[model samples]
Target: MRISACCFKFLAIIFWICPTAIAVAQSNDAQRHVIVISIDGFASYLVDDPKVPLPTIRRLAREGCVVEGGMTVSDPSVTWPNHTTLVTGMKPGRHGVLANGVLVRGGIGVPVKIDSHRDHSDLVRVPTVADVAHAAGLRTAEVNWPCTRNSKSFDDQFPDVPNALDYTTPRLRQELVKKKLLRDETHASFRNSSIVGLDYVWTEAACHLIRERKPHLMLIHLLNNDATHHKRGAQSQAGYTANAYADMCVSRIIDAIDDAGIREHSTIILVADHGFTVTPKAIRPNVLLREAGLLTVENGQLTQAQVHVVPEGGIGLVYCTNPLKASEQAAEFKKLLTGQEGVADVLLPDRFDEVGFPHPRDYRQVPDAVLVAKDGYAVSGTVTGETLVTTFEEARTSYGSHGFLAKLPKMKAMCILSGAGIRPGTQLQDVHNTAIAPTIATLLGLKYPDADGKPLLNALRTSADAE
Candidate 1:
């Protein structure tokens, strides 16, 4: 039977549009975007704490999966290393970022320092989730994300470093300057800006990227809360204010996604590098080292040293510059470090692997031993000071600090995954920050087989079905 003219025309139109519509739908599905917001010192406990006014974070937690106990950060719970773990799904040992900065070995007679002015390639040994996604033709952005300086993987990069303005992607920096989101383009202006002001600037940068580019994978980091906590201690009134501001920043990001018309298609993961611990005492292990003749200081300068302890918040990395001497006086060093005030225990190099750190024998950045600070104590790098231990009041004032053993409950980081393919109100017992990257990789329809973490299958729609 011959079709009527009107029906024929209608059928023709349907046939012609069908393929294009199908392709559009497929493209939309493939265009899933992920926004990861890291509140630097957001403790898991604070998510439920009635005192910390984080309505936005709490709402997200209510809508998404919340790690019950808390997410365990990498060993020596610190910012850069844990942030790297969140994106790489690997610990410090594998990722090759042992500290907040690159740990430089100063050899036998020199003191070591963590050089923060380093490039991404100079620190990270493994590919991040952003790198993997970008390699697979997905657009990526990073705003104030650590260890991402000069990362070619990101389509837009605004790094978190001393001279952050100098390293930002040229186009993005110009755009930001033109918009006055960044008032001045100079690194000095950025450095002089207050922590709270910089936090707002960083959030504005992230919001701009979301509205303008809608990157497939975007990582945003806000730092005011961490700085505030470091100054006034966690749960302090000042910390509450900073945290509230960070929550507002998160709200702004969500708004930007909605404005970009990709709210429904986007996934937001709220995380933290590590939790904070209020320390009243500061332990100066270097003083003990000097007294023990393991270290030497002259003319108020550390001109020479056998073993130098670099304090990293609640933990101290004891570097034995002379490996042979370290072996010879291992027992003596242990005796001196062990049972000291504010000293919890000394972790020898042999146990480094057990705690997800590279052994000193293999990695020069690895310390000969790790001095674990006890609760209410923080390690300090004061060799010239007469006292081996002192109260926080004497130094400045009692403040909050992190970089403790990952096993400590106080060192647990925060984790909240929401939107897109996530199951609302889902909860996991205790998660590791390492698992975050693989989960993000799965959400982006990519495989990160080499990652040490497994995706949170129970919290994801497609993966949960597979389970």
Candidate 2:
């Protein structure tokens, strides 16, 4: 009974291989670890923002490949859809998460902002890279990544694991508590606490996992930067602080890998969900509808509404009462929105497919028409008598916002990759969001058979070798 050479070598690191042909292949490959860090609201332009010294981010750029043109976020350019797209290699249209929330049957639904603890895995129609990696015998971990609640793709999960926002693993919590990094009041009230405090707790938890569990594939989403930028403009003092804080968080995770003796064996990928733009003007198209008696607000309830403007920052979806008469309503909507101030482009149903939007026939919440705000203008969710156009200083304004058309240069997301088997100091252009999952999956020697993205080969060691 002679055992094969490959089988003997696999037995040496038996823990890494779960079992299967692909797992065997991955175990044979040099790639071992992947730690994906998603910094929400990070724009490609920030890679050179001279305002502050983003030491960690700059280090990554200096040492690894930077996707120069930027990673194009999914349409609507919101959080959850793009995050899901990052892992699944599918657009929001293909992945069934067309937006943060779906507008259903002429009624708007709450966004799936935070993943529910229930088995909502079916919400995503496609399999994530984690699922593929897990199937290939790799342990996966997710910390506060959207659409990952109760997901079977991961073996070790925090935040999503216990239906809690903080990584409340009993031991992990206690360790931070003893270290004076966490207190009961702070941990218990994290949901209502400052963005910095919540992120501090989460970052420590990620470090704990990396130092202890050492998952083969780990994804960490930091929300402080997004929250801060939304409150203060992207170039504001607070925005700089939030981004610097995110950089530090990444540094800690990298340190954890080094402390765990897996630095050389691990691969680190940095990406942002979407970019940011300072929205100086607010447009409330619904205000006009209310004035025209097309919509009614009785005690703040939408009672009689013919059109509902579902505001998504720089973009708005005008939903008609009759999806059956969408064609007719679209024509009216185009004229109605075109006459309104701060409206950049009124995209009708015919342009949905052109802009990579989910066709009306494919989505449950596809709107009659899309309204794009002009540069320096953003849409608001106000359906009442708010002004049609008002300065951000005068209105209840966001210092910054996203969810704009991806064609806008300022809306482009960022991607920085540096790790083992990657071409250091490489700069790739025209990188899209769909290409990410496939590259990560392929690096681990796993097959991303369903991926729509092409593997970014120019940044890889193989590509460098060919060169």
Candidate 3:
């Protein structure tokens, strides 16, 4: 969720420097290395121009297959939900990661704290590609990937470093302050939530494992760009500078592979969890509900409520604590919100089934009502704001936002593949995020028919077929 910024700040260290390298032992195994580096908010525009240069990622797009048509990601398009989609090969509804945070089951008359506490595995209901790969005896590793913090499937995991329990802050800070690259760097704009230092943290971990342990399947999540794009629209000068940093991080890992003597034998897949858009307007659904008298606030707290909303970026989950009355409540919402400015779509729980969501639902997280915003607007949870409209002048400085349904024109995510089992210099069309896992599973020599995604074989050279 938005936790990536605030949560990582506490573990702040300079990110400009690269970690010292340890002596690497040569690998004896014949297995291929699949290195996945996810740039959190990367989009196709970053590499579309042939004349413009994006050194590291551009090579990836040219040498590997670029999804020219754009890849459609999971619904709600938040980080965890979409990242979960990649490993599990399922959509949000089927995967059970309905939103960034789960809705509390019986906590209706209470102020909704949707994002406060969460565990990676708490929301996932199925086996991941890594789990299947691990079961097949292939070595797997994960670094800083969300929804994977607790997974036992990886042979080596730095699932959530810096912010998670594993990172010892003082020692890390000292090591970072000593590094040449990061020692001089400063994040003056905390508005974007600096991953400047943490980027090096994950990169070093992944690189070290690549040189030494050599896991067959490695997932490295690098996310500084996500924040910059969040506060600064993709077209902003700030976003470009941030993307350059993220690109350099990728180069480090790529260099690590070459140093491991496995460059030719490795496949480097670059992707993003989702795309972003600029929204200058805000829709405060909770404010509207409060004004409607459905939500009651007292003593600067939520004392009682009939209708409540958990605002995601461009989408919001409207919850009714009583399961029985959910339908009745949703019908009323359609009338109140549908024609309202900036409101595009409002859905009832029963319609969840049609969109690959679980409706007749299970557990505490299902939304009784769902809200989607028109382009240039975002759904905010700020209950104190004006009921219907609020101009977000803050974004005027560096404007961008995401979390609408993925099918919308601007929400397309990134997918680029190169190296082993992949054909070079190709362009792909109609790629879906769901297709990634099964194809990767096939490459890892593993099977996951249970996954909703199919292998995207068009991007593959004959080498993939031989594998």
Candidate 4:
């Protein structure tokens, strides 16, 4: 009888220890490494279509939590602002990155660098997910993320000088060398492409970082898709090719992670800063606004007289010189600009006020009135006469553009979450761009300060017992 009782006690202790051991293992397993990939011009329209030939992306969607329509925030929907929004989960208005270039006030141009290292102190307001992740004692790494030159967000960054005109092959190294932009050359590996070689280099650097550093939080931005779209338009074959190349790069990254034995313990997020649209024509709103005596241009410099028509589209950004005369000028301009071609939506400053946007005093980073152009219709340059009325045949240069309203289905970005704690094959609808930061925070069990996005509980697995 004594021997039998001892045996029973020993069995009970074994059962208790077994469950505790499993729990500890599970907790360790949940400490996953997150890899975030942002393809500059990736669109859901391309991802959802099987004809696009993206096998890896399709597989990721199948194996992860895929948000079919991840909405973006607002327009002129350039790269810098949109990329800022993706990590910070804030709109351009909130983040103070209203556009790719800084707003020129009184003929004094505000300096803007694509590299965050060069930004003014007053610009970056919010802490990004990378910052929050680092705060939580997680390792973070970034490669060629936009607005990184003068930024203090990432623990590791490969900064690139921001120059729209410096896209040539020979100029690539010169920009890096002269600017002293990049942190480590080992993180920079060039991949040959028909268009841009540096884009592949950025991807290779990201792969190297993942293999070497194995950061808990990683953000990689690939720009070739956006570059190709800029040159070939959104609907062109070159755009598709660029998208495929980006997909291939993603596959290589995934393979690298898998080979490192971190595949199952890693959560991969694929996002695009914004979608792209083709510009078929250019409409010069400033021409009409200047004609109405609302604007003054002398010696190639524009001065605000009574009102300013700033282009949120390609060409004009209107600013009101005299606040009291805004209504009268706006009324006149509205009358004259009605039925204008290429005009998508017009928002007055008062409308912005109604929407709880910061007052012009606070939101002065942007223009007084924003004019969004319809698909294929962009704003014209400040050049005189004939340039203003150029048809799509003449002005339809860029293969793709974004920065319209985020409410449009076409403008929506994508969000995919996969790995430990995430429910496989889960589909989330109506996910906002604001929700991303919070989701990432929750996955890492970190607290994000003042983040607007919520943790996606639906994407998480139920308790182990339930599973």
Best by TM-score: 1
How far in Å is the alpha carbon of 4 misplaced in model 3?
A: 31
> What is candidate 2's CA lDDT for residue 145?
79
2 or 3, greater by lDDT: 2
Q: Rank the candidates by TM-score, best first.
A: 1, 2, 3, 4
**What is the Cα-based lDDT of residue 365 in candidate 2?**
57
Ranking by lDDT: 1, 2, 3, 4
| Residue lDDT tens for model 4, 322-361 | 5556456655665666667766666666676432244455
Q: What TM-score against the true fold does each predicted structure earn? A: 0.92, 0.87, 0.85, 0.79
Q: For residues 1-467, could you state the per-residue lDDT of candidate 3 as single tens digits? A: 12232222222222102111111222346467789888888866666634434699888888888898578888878888888888878987666677655555665455445552456556566667776666566778887777765576777765542244342233333443365323422323211334777777668767877887788889888888888898778767888887888888889999899999888889888888888889988777777788899887776455667777777788888887666676788789878898998999997866765456665344356677789888889887666655586776622212577788787757787789999889888888888899888877766666567678888888877754577
| lDDT, candidate 1, 1-467, per-residue tens | 32232453354345333433211222444679999999998988888888888888889989988998789999879899999999989888777788889888877777788999999978887667777777666889999999999987899999988799899999998998998977778888777879888988899999999999999899999999899999898788998888889899999999999999998889999999999999988988888888878778888667788887888888888887877787556556778878878889888866776677755666678788888989889888877777778987664434799988888898888899999989988999768888999999888877776678899988888754537
lDDT of 2 by residue, 34-89 (tens): 89999999988887889966899889888989998788887878887888889878
Candidate 4 has what TM-score?
0.79
Which prediction has more favorable TM-score, 1 or 3? 1
Residue-pair clashes per candidate, as listed?
0, 0, 4, 28
lDDT for each candidate structure: 0.83, 0.75, 0.72, 0.62
Position 412, candidate 1: lDDT: 89
Query: Which pairs, if any, clash in model 2?
Result: none
In candidate 3, how many clashes are counted? 4
